[model samples]
Target: MSRNKQAKRPKLANEGFTGRLRFFVGRALLNIRQNAFVNIVTIGTITLAILIISLFMLVFVNLEGVANDWSKRVQVTAYFEQELAPEELATLKSRVLAIPGTDRVTYVSKEEAFKRFRERLKGQELLLEGITTDVLPSSVEISLKSASRNSDAVAVYVDRLKKVPGVTEVQHGEEWVRRYTTFMNFLRLAGLLLGSFLVLAVIFIVSNTIKLTIYSRKEELEILSLVGATRFFIKAPFLIEGILQGASGAGLALIILTGCYYAFLHNAGNFLSFNPAAAGLAFLPPVYSVGLFVSGVLLGFIGSATSLKRFVSV
Candidate 1:
C-alpha cells in the first residue's frame, strides 16, 4: 500500500522532515497491520521481556527504600561519665554534632532514659519498681549521616564520639551492623548484575525480532533499492515500525506491571504477618516510571538502527 503511495511521489522528491516522517509513520502502521501476525508475535515477545525488566526494577527500588529506612535507625549512643548540668549538656551536644559523619545529636537525661526503659517494660512494671532515675545513665544519641552507615564507618564514628569530653563510653550494635552492611552490599551487587543482564537480554531480543521483520520484507526492500531510493528513505518506514512496536510493548508491559503491583498490595495483607503498606512497600517513583518511557524510546531507536545497518548501505 505504501509502495503504491511512493510510486507516484517519486524517490527524489523532497517532502521536508516533518512531512516525510508523517508519511513514514502512516506507512509503518499500514505495514504492521498487513503483517499482523508476525508483528504481534514480535511485540508480544518484547512485552514479556520489558515486563520482566520493569518487575525487577520495582522490587529492587522498594527493597532499597526499606533498607534506607532501617539504616536510618542505626545510631550510636554515648553515655556520660556523670550527670551534666543544663549548659553542660548543650555544650556536649554541640561538640558531638561537630564530629565527623554526625547528622544529629539528642541528649536523653537520666529521667528520660528510665522513662524509655519503663515504657519497654510496659506490662512488667515490676522489673522497674526499684529502679530510679539516678540508676540510669544520661546519654547522647548520635545519628550518622547516610554516607557513614556502613559497619566500618559506624565503628570509626563511634570511636570519635568516645573521645568527646564527658562521654564515658559509646555503644553501637557492632555485631549486627556488619551483617546488615554486608547484606545491603550483596543486594546492590545482585541488583546491578541482574538489571544489566535483563537489559542486554531485551536489547538482543528486540534486535533479532527486527531482523526477522526485515527478512520478511526483503523483496520489497530490494525493489525500493533498485528504484534508487536513498538508504534513509528506504529504511524510514521500517525504523518507524520498530519504534512503534517498542513503544507499544513498553506501554503494555508497564500497564501489566501496575496491575500486578496493585493486586499484590490488595492481597499482601491476607497472608503476611506485617502490613506491606506500613512496611514501606510502594510502586516505582515518578522519576523511574518516566525513565522506563525514555528507555523504551532509546531501545526502539537502537534496535531499528542496528537492524538497518545490516540491510541498508550508507
Candidate 2:
C-alpha cells in the first residue's frame, strides 16, 4: 500500500501542470460568458481608446511624409558673374557637381532667367518692359539630395557655394526652412504627450474592470484556496480573461479603422487629387499595426496583474 501511494504521487505531479492550464482556460471562458455586460463595457472602452490613438498616429505619419516631400523640393540658386567665357562656365559646372550631396546642377542662362521673371510678372508686364536679359545674371540652380536638404546641411552648402570662384550670390531660403522644422517639431511633441495620456487612461479603465470581475468571483477564489489550490491556479483565469478582452477590443478597432480609412479615401478622391502628397496617403505601416495589437495585449496583461496583486493578498 505504501509503494502504490508513492507511485501515484509522481503521476499526480506530472498531470498538475496540464490540469491547471485547462482549468484556467475553461474558467476564463465561463467568466466571460457569465459577466457579459461588464465584458462588453470593458471591450468597448478599449476599442474606443485604441481607435483614437491609431487615428492620431496615422495623421502624424502622413504629415511626416509630406514634410519630407517638401524638403526634397528645396533648391539653392547661385547667381554667377555675367559674361563668363565658355571654358569658365564648364569648369564651374564640373566643380559644383563634384560637391557632396549635390543631386543635380542646371545652368540657367541670363535669357532663361529673364523669361522666368517675365512669366512671374504676368499682368504687370511693365515691370520688365525696359529690362533686358543682361540686367539679370546667369545662375546655376543646385538641387541637394534628399538627405542634404535640412537647414544645417543647406547652410553648409551655401558656404561652399560662396567659395566657388565664379559664384556671386547664393539663396537657399534658410529662414523658411527654420520655420518649417520648428513647426514639425512642435507637432511631434504634442502627439507624443497626447498618446501617453490615452495609454494611461486605457490602463486605468482596464484595471478597474478586472478588479470588479475579481470581486464578483471572491467566493469561488476562497473555495479554491481552501481546497489546496495554489495562488497561481486561482489568479490564472482572471489573467486570461483580461488578455481576451484586450485582444478582442483591438481586433474590433482595427476593423472599424480600416473601413473608415477606405471610405474616406474613396469619397475624398477628387479633393486629394489637388495635392500630390494627399494622393499617396496610406494607412498605418505593417510594423505599426503589429505594434498596436501588441500594445493592447500588454495593456490588458498589466491591468490584470495590478488587480490580482491587490485581491490575491486577501
Candidate 3:
C-alpha cells in the first residue's frame, strides 16, 4: 500500500470511534427535539411511576424500623410472691438470670415499686394515704437477647421462670407481639406487590413510547436497510436514544426526590427538633440512582429496537 494511504488508515480508524459516537448523539438529539412532546410524555410517565415506587420504598423501610424498635422495647416483668423467704427470692432471681435468651435481669424491690406508685399519684393525697411499700409487689425486669424475644421462644423461658421458687407471675403475651409482627409482615408484602405493579407499568409505558417513535421513523429505517446499512449502524442511534432517555428520566426523578426530602425535613424540623440521621428520608442510594438512569435508557432503547425488528426483517 502507498505510504499516504497507510498513514490515512490509522487516522480514519481513530476517527471512526469519535465519529460514530458523535453521530449517534446527534441523531438521538435530533429525534428527541423533533419529537419533543412525545419525549416529554414518555419522561413524565416513567417519572411518576418511579416517584411512587421511591416513596413506597421509603415508607416501608421506616415502618420496618419503627416496628423493630417496638419489638426491642418489649420486655417481661416477673412479679414475686410476698411469702417467699430471702434465700428463696435470691435463688429465684439467680435462676431467672441464668435462663436461656435472658440478656440482663433487673430486680425492683417493693420499696422502689411503692415509691414509683407514690410519684405517679403524687397529686392525689387521698389515693396515696393508705398505700405503702408493703402492699407493692417485688418484681424482676427481664430483657431477652434478640433470638429469645420471639413469643414461642420466650414462652419456654417463662415456663422455666414459673417453676422457680417465689415466682408468682411470668408476664409476656404471644397474642400482642404476634399481632404487631403480623402487621409489619403485611406492610412488607404490600410494598412488594405495589412495587412490582409499578415496575411493570413503567416498562410497558416506556416500551410503547419507543414503539411509537420507531413507527414514526419507519420510512427512514427502510431506506437505511435498502442502502445495505448493517443492523448495528441502523440501531446504534436508537440505542443511544434509549440511554439518554434513561439517564435524563433518572436525573429528573432524583432532583424531584431531593426537593421532597428537603421540604419534608424542613417541615419536620420546624414542628419538632429533627435529626436528619434518624429520619432516613426517601433518598435513593447512589448506586440505585445510577442503575435507574441506565435502566431507563436501556428500556427505551430496547423497546425501540424490538419494535423496529419487525419492520427491519422486511
Candidate 2 segments exceeding 4 Å error: 1-23, 82-107, 122-134, 144-153, 268-280
Model 1 CA deviation exceeding 4 Å by range? 1-14, 123-131, 271-275
lDDT of 3 by residue, 272-298 (tens): 777655666446667766766676667
For model 3, the stretches where C-alpha displacement exceeds 4 angstroms are 1-23, 79-111, 125-168, 264-298, 308-311
> How many clashes does the backbone of model 2 have?
0
Candidate 2 lDDT over 213-239, as tens digits, reads 667777877888888878887788878
Which candidate do you rate higher for TM-score, 2 or 3?
Answer: 2
lDDT of each: 0.84, 0.81, 0.74
Indicate the worst ten consecutive residues by lDDT in candidate 3. 5-14
Model 1, span 211-294: residue lDDT tens: 887777788888889989989888888878878887888888889999998888878899988878777788989888777866
TM-score, one value per model? 0.90, 0.77, 0.70
RMSD of each: 4.5, 4.4, 5.8
- Cα lDDT of model 3 overall? 0.74
Which candidate gets the maximum lDDT versus the true structure? 1
lDDT of 3 at 272: 71
Error of 1 at 70 (Å): 1.7
Clashing pairs in 2: none
